[model samples]
Target: MKDVLMNERHMLSRRKMLGGAGAISAAVAAASVSKVAMAALPEPVIQTKPDTMPPLVPNTGRPYNPVVTLNGWTLPWRMNNGVKEFHLVAEPVVREMSPGFKAHLWGYNGQSPGPTIEVVEGDRVRLFVTNKLGELTSIHWHGQRLPNGMDGVTGLNQPGIPPGKTYVYEFVARRPGTFMYHPHADEMVQMAMGMMGFWITHPKGKHPLIDEVDRDFCFLLNAYDIDPGAATPKIMTMLDFNLWSWNSRIFPGIDPLVVRHMDKVRIRVGNLTMTNHPIHLHGHEFLITGTDGGPTPKSTRQYEVTADIAVGQMRQMDFLADEEGDWAFHCHKSHHTMNAMGHDVPTMIGVDHRGVAKQITKLIPDYMVMGERGMKDMTEMEMPLPDNTAAMMAGTGPFGAVGMGGMFSVVKVRKDQKRGDYSDPGWYQHPPGTVAYEFTGALPDPARFKADVSPGPGSMPSMAKPAQDVEVKVRKPAGGHSGH
Candidate 1:
């Protein structure tokens, strides 16, 4: 079933390159293979240096992490007596991916997506928002719980955060965990346009409840709507708002979600689009310890191989990295993998027509024929070869191995952990380990915000039920580390 389409051509090329009068000896071949095995996978992509930019301004004195002081009443505020307002604005902006195709998106901070807001559990949160766009707006504290009056609803709980005027949302932070805040006013228009961010809540304790852990990381999932060509922007209709992304855009092959070897990574994934994404990673399953609110009941904690993160939902999961390799993490939706406005073209090497086109052709050749003639001619009996970059990264063939069905990503688990024993909790330790690494990437540098950032309140006022008495215990793999 694992048919190699052009294996002969590749083999011939390999033989020609490795053979002849200057052929490599057996020892050299063995050495090369060993070296290849030992070498680390390529690093995930980094920030691109903008070619055109404003002149640099001299640095002003500032701290590594800036803080803004807020004067709160020393007296405790009652949840029953007061209501607060929070306003969120949704607007479309063009980001320069390239002149040919700027990223057309809707954002809350006047850009695609919005800013992250972290608050302490039990803190009173009042969100005041003013919408400047033509369409109406409202903010739904997704996965958050407070009084029902503060729920951002266009018609149900309160009026929409109307255009030109401010809307206030006052609520008390009860439970704590990672969550999201986005527009619920006109989901089709608002989510498509951007208007979302992380609403994190920190537990009152200084350290994690567990004794051995080190750090935490948070990730936001999103899909973008971008049209490759045609200067005019593409409007997101209810049916065809077709761009998908995690964080913000399609991650280039080289630039992907990453984690260090032998590290503990906590990922908080939120889905705001109309679609659901069954997020999957190659190599291992992750522990689902937390949900929209706080930690799940110990008895009900899940280790998910493929978690379904649906629209208007959020999930918190963690995993340890015991193997070292580049991991490709992405949405399992067949349509979400679409890049560059759903053009169905491969990222071929060296074809620089547009930034997207050139990247596609150069980096991922398998997709070169996606929209080509007869490409869509497959009958129900015909299953085409998998051409996704993620599949290649996972080294799996279509219909022949794992990483198929659009549910795959690279998760580099370091090889430093003891093979026969996975008992150590070293992976979650702080600094360069799990906790610091995951949160560091998302938390803005001091330069971005002049305010304190920490976790905040989020949970539905309507909880399934108060979790009854549950036992807590350390978890172990069923077979007790088979060293597989």
Candidate 2:
């Protein structure tokens, strides 16, 4: 049956090739190549370090710039194909220190979101596991390909890495990209307790587009749910778990992550926390070169200010640090920005239904009550405004022109001196009242603008002031806190 399917797919591909029009689908290609043949293909190799790639810039600190040892966790391999024999165990620790509240969490290794493992492209990764906890655990290489033994499926491929038994994962890093490793076993509980890390692979040599950049850095975004001190998860629903964070903590409140000006950082975005994060970076549009584990073609590539990082997906973005400052990076989901549900409030009032309902009443006027199960109860809920809405509204400045949507972060580029605010024609300046013209519709032709608008002097940062109040009110619904 498999042979017949492959032959049919091959014939179809040939026809499509001769037709010379539509794009070839991966499914069709996979069907054309037998699974056995694919398994036999040799892994791709990486040569020397790319000369074009820039060295990593050390952060501002006592050492001025240091090669810090990035910590990471090694999870046991989960078995697949119904063969559940091996067992893997690990107990990780997590903590929530936002909103002036300190709450401990459960994780696989020692951290909330495990540390990052950085390697140059083509390096073979020999993953070893040591079960530290009472429960069995395993890690599934989120997107990287490996041999059947290393696939980490609990039954068919191999047995689980039993507690106290070491499982060695050996695989060639065939692709240079961002990948994740997490426990696939009992995903609902294990992942919630935090069994994950960012696996970043770099190209062995410099590529044309990135060689000129000054530095490289990596960032991972992760979210978590907690039941206070318990090592297990308090699952709210099958799909909508309530915990939220980045690298496992809300932004701004967490230590400020920094980057130098003109440095090219390779941000490896991983969304493992069951929610899609609309990540937006301030100042520049990052080039998204890869997704999952493979290189994305030039046509489908994206260069955008805001991009969605779906749950269980990874996105690799290359951005030049043209702007410098304390850039704020966070999940676009408003709830994730706070320490916890109703977190911005004075106390730890977990998921206040009444407060939420009352706030909803203000944003959405007509409130209807659905007594029993039905669609009548559902109404359009209010949403948070765009992160850059204020900047855009402030009108036609260079920074103001870029609208926001993706998970947001800032890059502070160094400036020689401050140029006064306002669009002056002598330097790079748009004509007065041009801000309205930019967002309302198509941009005016550059030729129409006066030549004086060309670059002249540096300018001061025009901090955005949103006309509308940015505070998000949280009120419990008609019911009390007991609703959850």
Candidate 3:
């Protein structure tokens, strides 16, 4: 039976090839190749060090290696007559978002948010793409100034790369900056299904700001609308999304940004989602040093606690890991921090459903009411979900359940951390007297907190007027003198 099916597919492919360009359904090709065969293929060699240029100057006060992608790696390339050559295969992939959850996606060279392509400025690149997907596709080099012929736009720039066909894109790495690549054909569906990757071009010579970073990391920001139990994303979703990811991975499962204290860190963030993401980094201030266009001018650099990366945009943030702690880095939008939220579920807070639940339980023994007081209980409950549904709110930290998911991760900076060590440093340990504590007895004197009300030089003016002589009142507990 399998042989018959194979023969039929071959005949169909031959007919399609005769009609026009060589074409074959991705499903048919995938069926022809077994999982074992795909696994048997050798891993792509990732060249971390540049061969043509001198080594980058040490910036982080420690030796710098290739930026370690938490759950990712860089793509290797070969030099052919001074031009770098890279081979990328576009096919289907089952990516593990975190433990216990995976999504079926289409990407290049086996991984979604395909492997990072790193090159030096002025080097010409010859990228060969082989399409194994069931549909036709094209790759648009987002933000790269390439010739119109190699732009990778179907019907506009050139004909799309049909299934089972190969196309070559040659361009010079003109500017040193961050860029992205994704399918221009069926972009809405393909990009939503995780077809994207990072492109990094380093300056040919000494670049003080860009080359000084102790650690440089890049990842793509994408979103999906897969329900809790589904294995595939809903490609039709426009705005309302459930799974927010960095490189198709959610928090906890996403690798934490690890660095040593005082290390100069550069985080390259690319947003491909429908909405803009105000990426906030806790416990530190950073400067937006670069964008998709190119490096930001030094005069335009400013310190910011949060930087907003809009859709189809990329930004590079530079900062010093001077503070030793486990700080959070995530999207500021509250809903963007969660996964697989059921949008249709009605609010059950403040409702007593016990009576109705009891009646329903008589008919369905396993039925239970939820969200009575709030959604907090749902985070703890392990309800029967669909076969492959991802836990909407999952992951537990050392303190307790994190109670959050999606576009979130931690930045672990420790003074004792070893150089090149990417392991988690665990949670931050606060020093005694540093942690906030309640004063139970009486209100503290206001005079002790009135040191520096005046704005410092170069400080922006306060948005609101300061309060004048505000009175302080401490309310006694209902049961007075109940333990201090």
Q: Candidate 1 lDDT, tens digit per residue, 1-484?
A: 0122112211211112123323323322332124222112111111122121111111221111111101000001112123211223345554432222345566653344454555556666655454556778878887788778777777887776545454556677777776777777877666666667667666645434321222244445655544434322344544444445554544332122344566666666777665677887766678777777567766776677778987767777677766454455766666555444333334333333455655777777543332323222212223333222112112222223332212233443445544322122222222354322234457655666436776468766764655786566544445332232
Scored by lDDT, the top model is 3
lDDT of candidate model 1 versus the reference: 0.46
| lDDT agreement with native, every candidate | 0.46, 0.46, 0.74
- Where does model 1 exceed 4 Å of error? 1-89, 95-101, 206-215, 230-236, 239-241, 253-255, 341-484
Give the alpha carbon lDDT tens digit for every residue of 176-287 in model 2: 6668777766666666656666665556676433332333344456554443333335654344344454555443223333445456555657777665788777667888
Model 2: residues with Cα > 4 Å off, grouped in runs: 1-89, 96-103, 208-213, 227-233, 236-242, 342-410, 415-484
Candidate 3 lDDT: 0.74
Clashes of each: 52, 51, 3
**Candidate 2 weakest lDDT stretch, 10 residues:** 43-52
Models 1 onward score TM values of 0.53, 0.54, 0.77
Among all candidates shown, the one with the greatest TM-score: 3
- Ranked by lDDT, the better of candidates 1 and 2 is 1
lDDT of 3 at 46: 23
TM-score of 3: 0.77
